[model samples]
Target: MRSRSLFSLLTLVGLAALLLTACGGGGSKKKASSSSSGQAGGTLITVAKGAPSGSPDPQINYTLQEWQILIISHDGLLAFKRTSGTEGTKLVPDLATAIPKPQDGGKTYVFHIRKGIKFSDGKELKPSDVKYTFERLFKIGQSPNAGTWYNVIVGGDACVKTPSTCDLSKGVVADDAAGTVTFHL
Candidate 1:
């Protein structure tokens, strides 16, 4: 019992030390915010990173630093709340109307995307874009340790394992008129 208690205390100390190091340089900058500058053109926000941010592609990059930039520059179907609290971890719809309704015994998912969400190119986001986005991930297979999004879709594992032998369009359906994207798992 004594040994177990000592181990727990040591673990707690190590975790606290790591947390302190991570937050040590993240002090707030009062004069840099858009609110103070009165800039109406766009909002300016900043994030502190311990290391350089690499590629910003969601499929090509998986590091915490890359995700920080992606979250700011692009919209996901869902996003985490940006609070300085526990709620920041909770998922919220960014491009979609809400979390999708699961069907077919949790094997199918239908997402209703929001209308008038334009990309940087001024093109309105379409359901087909979602399908293309997902397909690109499998096609690129950026790194061996890529996330398993392809593994969850129907025939997606086969596509990732052997891209030449698979057809991604058969797995996802995008209805532009209905603003819906369906994933067949």
Candidate 2:
């Protein structure tokens, strides 16, 4: 009788352990499946602020609208190269085929533009566009939001001669002829 009782107690303990293990495994699997399902379909992001200052130009005010428009409109040298989102929002090649670096004196940086990319108005994005954007910011003396990114480029100060000239030099150059841009700095 004593032997039978001990055997029964051992069996119950083993059964309880097995049951707990099974429950834990099922819960983990369920959580993982739910998380993956949620992420499988891309996410939709909405901002409270309405459309920005109509101008998609980044040199203007860096408003919420402007930032959204830029992300939607223009391509940068190295876009969200370190982004934490979907393929579209992920940091990938944008206007440039690849991010270029300075070869000579760490001053002259060249960016190779991607072919066949067009603006909303059906205009091709050339290397000159990049150059013009940089120059414009320098001319503006401040970012659309009053920040200073223009100063980082070479010839930035020289580009800012007068207000009109400043506008011309506010952005980086997109040279159509060479299919690349060389930032002075």
Candidate 3:
């Protein structure tokens, strides 16, 4: 009897969810701009994280201010949607074309970056750029301010230790022509 009650409750919940979606829960609803706005591009907002911005190199700065600016200026391999629905909080591909599935018993992740993405310098981004970014992070981010980049990537720690002698490229395989980067754990 308890199992039957549970099943019925679940059925009703599912039906309610379906009804909400059908009623356009996921539909695009245009928002009306406020009449009081002055600028044509809307008001410019300034945010500060209560600290002075430091280090132009992204891998070196760990302060909130640095992160805030970086968040606006940079794109990552993945991103989360800002929506409040089911899509929110889910990891979606950003620079990469899609979320990579782990391979080699969850020890490897291959990312296929979108083609034609350009840097501020107007140069087209390639898979080698991603590899270089990761490598630079591990190499430059040293002791006192070394962020989590070294801890996350597979060969990051070793790369930091030997920076010159070590071949840290083992962790990242970049196929420039194919726009794919494979990270080995």
Candidate 4:
């Protein structure tokens, strides 16, 4: 009777070990398979801002409708790469391919424009378009968002003056030759 009891106890222990191993292995495989399937991507993001002025032009104030239209309609040089906090801070890269950099004694700056981009009007974006856009911004007076470009480029201050003497001719220059732009301070 003692020998039979010992054999039965060993058999039960072996079975329990096998059951635990199988349970652990099974869970890991299921998790690995699910994670692989979840790697597919197709995402859209929604954001809200305090009342927008509705104008599509970032420089102009229109209405909330216009602001929404602009947000959807336009892209910038570089967008905020990320957002943080409860204020819903975000990364914003609009029309630029990369951040601008100064050259030639801080008087000249160059920017590389993103390729294969188009405007809402179906216009292909070129360095010239960027030149025109910045030119327009300067002509319109200091935008409320003036700080966006103020320190980034030179002549931003003069460009904001009323009946502005902002010498755009000497300031913003487009190098169609290289598909790059240069801003002379």
Model 1, residue 102: what's the lDDT? Answer: 55
lDDT of 2 by residue, 1-185 (tens): 54343333222212111111111111122344544344557777664554346544455555555455445444455555435557544334445566454455444456676676655445676666555554445555545422233444445455544544553332244467879765543
Candidate 3 regions off by >4 Å?
1-43, 84-88, 141-152
Best prediction by lDDT: 1
Evaluate residue 127 in candidate 2 and report its C-alpha lDDT on the 0 to 100 scale.
65
Which pairs, if any, clash in model 3? none
By TM-score, highest first, what's the ranking?
1, 3, 2, 4
Q: Which candidate has the highest TM-score of all?
A: 1
Q: Give the residue spans of candidate 1 off by over 4 A.
A: 1-43, 47-53, 143-147, 164-166
Per-prediction TM-score, please? 0.70, 0.55, 0.68, 0.52
Summarize candidate 3's per-residue lDDT along 27-103 as a digit string, tens digits: 23479778895656666768756556666455555556655555455666665554778886555556777767667
What is the alpha-carbon lDDT of model 1 when measured against the actual structure? 0.58
Candidate 4 residue-wise lDDT at 71: 40
**Candidate 4, residues 1-185: lDDT per residue as tens digits?**
54343333222212111111111111122344555356657886676666654544555553456544444444554433334574333333334455544456445556675565554344566666656666565566645544344423456566666415454555567776677766664
Q: For model 2, what is the error of residue 175's alpha carbon versus the real structure, in angstroms, after optimal superposition? A: 3.7
Candidate with more favorable, higher lDDT: 1 or 3: 1
Could you arrange the candidates by lDDT from highest to lowest?
1, 3, 4, 2
